[model samples]
Target: MRGLIAAAVGALIAGNIAAAAADNSFAVRDVRVFDGDKTIPLATVVVEDGRIAVVRRDAPIPAGLMVIDGHGKTLLPGLIDSHVHVFPGAEADALRFGVTTELDMFDISRDFKTWKAQRTSLGRTGQADTWAAGLGVTVKGGAPLEMLPPGMSVPTLDSAADAQKFVDARVAEGSDYIKLFIETLSEYHDRRTMPTLSRAEVCAVVAAAHADHRLAIVHTQAEWAAREAIECGADAIAHMIPDRVVGTHFIALAKRHHIFFETTDDVWAGASGMDFAQKLARDPRVAPYLSPMQRATLLATEKKVTPRFFPTVLANTRALHAAGVPLLAGTDSPNPATAHGVALHEELQILVRAGFTPQEALHAATALPDAIFHLGRRGRVAKGYRADLLLVDGDPTTNIAATLSINRIWMNGYPVDRTLPKK
Candidate 1:
């Protein structure tokens, strides 16, 4: 009789273990779902095996699945910051601000691949998915030459033949898009100003990139270079030129070619010369980084441009929005002025003020950017989309600022720890 009881107990334990394994699904219940257009209440989203298996209204909980009681929280597709430069601790900051995906515009291929791998590992360990464009290929001494320290400048080819060689080398090195930097005609013409690639050189780079099935994003102000970039089939304009109003021609062309625009107007609108002058004069975060000469320049900018010059910057961005071109959210983060993470949220708020509806701004941050980059399996909350999503305490459809109050983030169906304190 004892032998019979032992065998029966082993059979019962095996059945219970199998039942627990089957119950490993997750159900997020009673949440407000922002289904990319409208918000619906009392929605339940189910995830199993890292995919959203079901979305139903007032659905009963499936046995064995873990349930996340939403407590009337708002749910939306995870935010995407189309352009940023990542540094340490960016993952934490992104989750805190509801940014589920971040794209770096100028990272080395090897380092970028490593970052991508680590980001995937972070997702497995519950962090946001991180992506980057491997490097910005520019004329060695062009616009970036203006900012880079001596000896660190990337190469600038003199002739179209040299440009082809440069392009070939970069492709072999695994670059994503060829990034050309054009600031002024003088920079190209006058070697003293900043040695820039000739027009033929630029065209050669673009052609090479296209031949290799890559795109080109040119960093240029409105000028001959900008016009030339458009004519040469550049995939995107990195920023909106503020010096002159862009005419209907570029807009019509952009629409026709499906070219994208990343209006990084936030960097210009939120110029920190005045604020940083004050902060560098006294604050702890920046004072350490400033040399005495750098501090002097910051102080001088406040006296020169703070009150009168900023209005023009705001006016230009407003005009760009009226053009109805495809605008992507880019913060120019990790730069000296714009802070990373929360800065993209601020950029979205600025975008809304610049004439986009809350939904439109959210769309720019999510769907529009994803579509532009051809990033598959991200930027949505549908059944087949990657499980990159966020939860908020308030309805974003009502108040877009609720996006700033990110409560939880899920990347690849794994819960990431909130950088902000839990409510």
Candidate 2:
């Protein structure tokens, strides 16, 4: 009986895969284009063979191309979340809110290779494209181990050799980038401490990643750890500092090093109140795109009562941006009050509230991540690029909230099914 059930499930999965690869050509006409840098008032975008073939004003529509009327709509590159710990069902939920790409900070799944292949294949649809750091490098009793299952061995680096070995193993496993956990855990649990990677070890790991031509990103919460990560040659900081306000000197260092920061203020804000999550949960515009599981997660109560850190996070983000340090918008989804996909929209609002112009906030989620991570042919609406695009009803360049008014989403030129299934 179990074998029969397994076979049936496998067949259903295969059928869905086949259906996702069916459509790969279309044209969206008469839409305002946000080409990752500036806005074009009126333009036509044509997609053929899963690539954007033409983007111009008054272009002649070739015969046999499915034309989608984009009058009174805004076409932008699909959103990208730079920091997320993905599991099953996350990608589909991400796509529902027009997030066509998710940059996973850490993933431990054994089937990661399979998922990566599926995301890269031409004509793929339904789920967001994923790039991940297969397994984060951390100390034995450090962060993430507390959240992971018992007896699961995580690489603990105490020396430079260990760091090199760990990075090499991750590279062999096809990790897109290297993720380092530099958390101290003192703030999360009072009077308790966790082991952290030494500076030498971190430097070694970063050097190894650079030697392999991969970016090294670090997860840190305190200003001190963030400074250390930067000093150790980390290409990016995965989370904002929440313990205290960041100083201009630190911002200058980040700017000098060309280090990008991912603002995860939503995760911190969710703990103090449900405002962010509740707003999305109550939003009628996004209601149909959210799955049952995503809706429930968004509405769930906060489990941990950590000190309010969003204020500090927001202030630091503002300071960093003012100092010319590049910022990337990310919501640490499925963490507590934050859900997948929709939380990114909230993050953009937070950025706007924290002194970023709406256009800058939009670029943080799109072009910045692509440029920093070297994700070629994405995060832009241009000819010779993948047809990963989002069509919204309003001008998001001026009003960040307009991103939520999602009308259509295309991944590799294939339209997404926005309707939720009936229970």
Candidate 3:
């Protein structure tokens, strides 16, 4: 049904369209809105005080509200990146592509409380609001430790018994969730190996996180490792393995456990020598926004000489989607050949290739991740939701790629400038 927020029928109204840039109280007429879950064809959406006040069909503009023309455009809830590692300038970069929220897998900024406080009182912000895994739990010297800056010694678990105390410390530091690492695949192509927390340790850490009311997002790169983590009650798997075709048992196990996956498509594609970053750099819609470092990193991000596992990975993802497994769109960005904001759109594109409909892919990026991560009122365009929104030039539901043609944007009810940054 259509939800039209139109100008009053020959009655008094307040400000012109220009005023909506500063005022959140406004209604736009004749736009198709994808409200995260479904579409309201030709609806009027009312935003007041940074929140969606009404979403109805054929509704006259309330008195004293600004009205804008929305012909030939589509509106959607601002996108959410289900997986990212927030570094300096990452959030703003993401926002440029209309990604209003980022779920940070790991960061030790110790500013989560500040972030929480800021979002609760939103007026305007350049960066996307984040909830992070303050420190990922790993072995004493394992996995990402080699990738961290020298002298950065994050906490590690020695045994299952200490899991509770470790989670407590993270909670005290204002970590919004728990990230458990498992990198025990010793048979790499290079024959190099990494230590990992034992299965017992994984189970214990998951229990501790649940006890503290936090979701456990496990990092497992191997198929067996992912299945094992689910057996231990993980809330979500951070990255689905690209090493082999996902088995039916694993799919059934995941479905039975009610577990979801962060679809890190670009990571696997890049590892398989797909040149994902170069593809992004070539997109006219995305290239102009790339910073110098973003450009450099996109080309330099991980690349392997010989392609491997990507075909299998694609097959597994298609199977998972076909089996009705919940998949959240995430690009393990800035890894190799991936940038922040733009990578997420590429991710949705990949999901479409993996058999998700354009609307389903949008849900994975918006409402699904927001609701799964407990980010309140941010993923949908329903009444009482936050007014984080994007208005693009065409129908993304049909073109899928039309998301890049951004028209206007609102973050917490404040219009985004979308100018090129000076970075």
Q: Model 3: runs farther than 4 Å from truth?
A: 1-20, 185-190, 303-306
- In model 1, the worst 10-residue window by lDDT is 301-310
The clash count for each model shown is 3, 0, 10
The CA lDDT of each predicted structure is 0.64, 0.84, 0.84
Instruction: List model 3 lDDT by residue over 372-405, tens digit each.
Output: 8889889999999999999998899877888988
TM-score of each: 0.77, 0.91, 0.93
The best candidate in terms of lDDT: 2
lDDT of 2: 0.84
* Deviation from native of the Cα of residue 30 in model 3, angstroms: 0.4
Model with the higher TM-score, candidate 1 or 3:
3
Return the candidate ranking by TM-score, descending. 3, 2, 1
**Predicted candidate 1 versus true structure: per-residue lDDT over 30-128, tens digit per residue:** 898876545677689887766677778877777878678887588777788877656555555565556778876665323555655755442354334
True-vs-predicted CA distance for residue 130, candidate 1, Å: 3.4
The list of candidate 1 runs beyond 4 A from truth reads 1-25, 37-42, 116-123, 146-153, 185-193, 272-322, 419-423
Query: Model 2: which residue pairs collide?
Result: none
